[model samples]
Target: MTDSQDFSNLSNRRRMTALILLTLTVFAIGTAELLPMGLLLPIATETKVSISTTGMLVTGYALGVVIGGPVLSALAGRLPRKTVLSVFLLVFIIGSIVCTAAPSYGLLLAGRVISSLAHGTLFGMIVVTAKNLAQPGKEGKSIALVGSGLTVSVILGAPLGTLLGQHLGWRFPFLVISLLSAAALLGIMKQLPPLPRSKGGSLKGQLRIVSRPDFLLVLLITIFGTGGTFAGFTYITPILERITGFSSDSVTIILLVFGAGSLLGNIAGGSLADKRLVPTLFGGLILLAVSMAVFTWSSHSKAAAVISVFIWGVAAYSIIPALNMLVLNKAGDAQELASTLNISAFNLGNAIGAFIGGLVIDSTLGLAAVPWVASVVTLLGIVLAIWSVILEKNRKCDRLPEYPFENRTA
Candidate 1:
């Protein structure tokens, strides 16, 4: 073999190894973020807090992500990417340890918020890093490769944590997460090559990118799309029990089905987005809307409910890769900040959707009406997506050349 060819092969192998470590880091991070939900009852009991107060763990984490992401991203902007990622992992490990040892509810909440400060920034950096490492035409797939870690966390990590908490104790899960984070940190430090510092853009310049018409529109699409899914999803357990007449065990199996569908959707979305960004976004939203609408009636039948739930999972997660790519494409040199803001946007949408769902359930509209509300919210996203596509076509947007296939009617 030629010397240059051997070097090229080695480079590819190293890149793949780095991507795998990043994916593992993401998985550990995701599991830590979601562990509280599965162990909420045990945590509340042990900490001597009400269940509602225990729920604040999630709320506090979300607030931290929104308020801290931009500040941290900007502050770390000039640091080497590897350094920033490693530091984030260390922060996560420390926070997890704090949670495991906290003697009071307030301390536990503090640990959660501290850990959450790394969530948005880490995701933003990881997405951008993966994109930079990707082969020219495989950017979407690379992003997907990292994103699958998060999806797998939902499917496997959280459930396993819950089981561990049930068998051992709630504290055990946090301890496990800390160990996982430590392992990921070691892998990142050893295997990942040094990445260059970001080109420092002025605060005003970063703000300008955030305020751009196209960029703002993409963020809005993310908000509405994510909100629509969580609207019904937040109430899924009750819906399955009361409306679908399923046993508790059956609900677990159905949720597993949903998670499996999300994994598939994440993969398919990335591959298609590489070829056609606009079309993939549109198709995902349309599918999401239709599935939620169908679910309104389908919930009456067990078999139909399971099928619709799977479709809902697929449609809900399928837009993520495309949306992340869109943010990077539009953010110019401020990709990290833009990506961080997008994560905040998603959490904002989650809060909004859950709030709206709660209001609907408390009112006369009730649980049965949630799917219809979800459909309507998703339809608004569809409208915005359509408007964005038209604007792109009229302006002959640069996205066309980026995706190659997007030059055709999206």
Candidate 2:
């Protein structure tokens, strides 16, 4: 592989172009992973299953990502990142094709799982790829740019796919996804080049990060902090329509507001992350906790719901870039493993947060109580983040440990 410094030699235009393609690649992967959620009803209807059972298709995708991110990254540790990306994109494409033609619900679930296996690991590689190419002081911004694909998928792809499914049947959306992934595959093949991997790291050696209590604490924060977003967000449609008293017809407009907030918040957070990692993260979580509280109150008024959901979107995503940067820093020499593990942490949080919301609904608290439960959970994250920040500050009294990496500015 060429020296990592070769990245710095590329002009700004080329760098931006590469980032755009990577963003689209991630966008495609994200769209496939989430497209199932939008088609749950139609799928359940066609496959002779209950709606709740079809929802498990989403659980299957998240599980695939949780398992695939770290495992796939570890097993492919020896391969060039470019090759890893290529093969995973191919896997995603094949998975989508299978979903398009699946003869049964079981087969459709299998295809979603197959496609999702590429979700986290490929995203891990994409982050490292973008970070490696970034100019000094731009790493957070670049990472956020790549991460924006997921937000865009929620905003554009999933909704459009849902619309297509309603019009042309559920199978058609997967076929569309297959076409999109094929384009991403060609983009990966053409736009990305061979990238170096850690020279001395082994999967077993990388897993040693699990033994470090300090890093594990950080991961815990990542789980709850990011997961807190989903706690309320997982049911935004119902919350807006049912609790906020927005007519069911206004749900799409509210959704667009929320998606717009996510995109803006992601970029704003990334910019802030570049300036100040700890303070920015702390502030983001603080605002996130506040936003959740705001939503709790805002859900009673229609106009308030719109404004609050938009702010909630911004506060929710703003912390991610900094949070992710913290993980990479904590993982030290095992940046790739740590990065992917954060992905797992994220998925785990989503499941747990959703469960928390579900519990609130099942109990006397009811659906209107969802954001209240989520707010308390987010406060826990804020507390943990504060502890981590203070601990890092005290540790600064001693010499910081060495973090290995190839020289990138060469």
Candidate 3:
């Protein structure tokens, strides 16, 4: 074979391996990030705090992710993306071990922050890599597949970790997370191809996009879209225990149902976005709003709630791959920086949702009220989406550049 054809074959093999490694890495991160939710009750009891106070740990971790994501991406701007990803996974492993060994709540909190610092940067790098690996018109699907590790973790990891923690000790989840992260590190070392160094505008230049109208609108969508999911999910364990009357052991099963729905949604969203980006986002947001609204009533009926969780999963995660695609598409020349910042935006939304969910629960509204509020926020997100569409149309009519990713590649 000619040199070009040989290179093509090598590239295909390498990309496939990278995809599997990325998926495994995502699984590890997902378990670590979400394990706390399942163990919230035990954590609260052990730490001598209310669930709401313990919820701050969630907010704290997300805050760390937001802070760490862009800063790390910017700092690592000169390094190979693959190398940076490997280091970040190593950081995650260390953090997980620290969390597992922590003797106090404060130490555990610190460990969570450490792990979170790796979360956003790792996700940003993975998404970019997945985009590069994709064939033409397959970027969305590729991102979704890499991202599926997270959804599967939510469906499979959290429940199992939670069950193990509840049955053993609360720290067991962290130990499992640590092991998983180590495993991911091994896969990454074995499979990921050597990546070129990042090339982009200075940190200041990239940050300038914060003021751009299109970027801001998409950032808002990320905030609201992700925040809506957290508002319900952050408080999910309590809601299941109190409302659905599921025991600690049984909560895992319900979460599995939710995860299953989310995994399916993640795949569907990617494929659909590959075909038509805007319409898929619009539909996903609408479905999210409807499902969040139904969750309020569904919480009172186990059967309905189970079904609702499935739909809620779909709506919540479907927007993720779509949002990442949309932001990169809009950012034009600054795709990597924009992509990393979008991950930060998503984490910021997570922080917002957890805080809001806590405030609602601490108030007289009770746990069931959380989903209703989430539904309203999701409706507001729909407005943002519509506005974005309108703005894009006007911009296009005025001869502005849009769909910047149309000709863009990683």
Candidate 4:
């Protein structure tokens, strides 16, 4: 009996280890996605292109994620999830290698697109894996813990890549991200447990949830809510220099400060969501809108702008984990596809925000106009969140699955 108990204990430990390692892969994916934002200037200089043209890298990557998320997740529906995740990370590694070696802007953009194609699928698989391993009544916190990796990457990866680009050159950042991607691939290969093929039915069954009102509402909330963050952040470096009067060398440090705030926000959002997911989502959206408005006004004052950036980082990120939980809870038994779709929604938000920001900057409105535009969009998101909350409050289910935990671990 003692030996049997010991074996069980060992199994639990191994699963936890695998979860942590998979979370690190989240970090790598997040790093690769955001690093280009900080390195865009150098990339543009090297390619002899305008900054507006360089912005295509971000737009293109986001488009790839939007296209790949649900499609790849559905296509891999019959395969072992662990195998799909491993292959996706390998794709990221290959793409990173191409990015590091690319001789022209066009080639680098292609590499980014290829790498991003794997983003949503990896995150979807990883989140489902995390859920399976979580203790009952703790799904939100568990998934949030894994998702926190992205926030951590923003805090560390973006700034580190920026400094590396400044000192070692732009190509070096991709090389470093490539190494991290390779590490993630090995970890997943060795540690990830096998996930069985879905017994729930075909891809059509999984996609049926997409037509639900809650899912559509949540997706819109994600698109507009997160879009608010990107509209300003896509141009943050320039804003820091042109508006805040910061030197090029100091921008990375400022970003680090923003990242620190995001780390705190991610953890806080997880905790709050575990207690009351709806209220947490509502509060986060409201705070985000208010913060963006202040950021628009504050950008001209260095001290105020720095403070606003920190606040913006916190408010913007605080909604991420909560939003994921909301969608998962709404999807009922079809959690995997819903989870994948949420990641796609986030990336879609990024693309929309970047495009709108570019439009405003290109017009006579200038970069300063981005924050106000973002603020209005965010306020609209707040309305959607409120509607979602009201819809759930009025929901008339005879049974609500006991909050998505009570039976998840099986």
Best by TM-score: 2
For residue 96, give model 1's deviation from the true position in Å: 0.8
lDDT of 3 at 144: 98
In order of appearance, the predictions have TM-scores of 0.94, 0.95, 0.87, 0.86
What is candidate 4's CA lDDT for residue 178? 93
Residue ranges of candidate 4 with Cα displaced over 4 Å: 1-12, 40-54, 103-107, 166-169, 361-369, 397-410
Question: What lDDT is reached at residue 22 by model 3?
Answer: 89
Q: Each candidate: how many clashes?
A: 0, 0, 0, 0
Cα lDDT tens digits for candidate 3, 1-410: 21112224446677777788888888888778888876888998988888988887777887888888888877876576768888988988888888889877888899999899999888888887787677767889989999999888877777789789989998888887788778878877877666664355565766676558778898999998898888878889899899888888778788888888888899999998898888889889999999989889888888898899999998888988889898877865456667878889887888788778889998999787999998887787889988887887777679875454353221
lDDT of 4 by residue, 281-367 (tens): 788888888888888889889899889889888888889878887777777546667788889998888878878888999999888
Candidate 1 collision pairs: none
Cα TM-score of candidate 1: 0.94
Query: Please, what is the whole-model Cα lDDT of each candidate in the order they appear?
Result: 0.86, 0.83, 0.82, 0.80
| Best of the two (1, 2) by lDDT | 1
| Span of ten consecutive residues with least summed lDDT in model 3 | 1-10
| Pairs of residues at least 3 apart in sequence or in different chains that clash in candidate 3 | none
Question: What is the per-residue lDDT of model 2 for residues 1-410, given as tens digits with 9 covering 90 to 100?
Answer: 32347587788887888888899988888887788788888899999999999998999899999988888888887787778888988988888998999999999989988988988888888877888878878888998999899999988989998999999999998998889878878877887766777567677778886548778888889889977888888877788887877777788888889899999999998888887787778888888888888888888998888888899889888988887888877776576778888888988999999988888889998888888779888888888877776676566546563431112210
Model 4 has an lDDT value of 0.80
**Lowest lDDT block of 10, candidate 1:** 1-10
Q: Residue 46: error of model 2 in Å?
A: 1.8
Deviation (Å) of 312 in candidate 1? 1.0
Displacement of the residue 312 alpha carbon in candidate 3, Å: 2.0
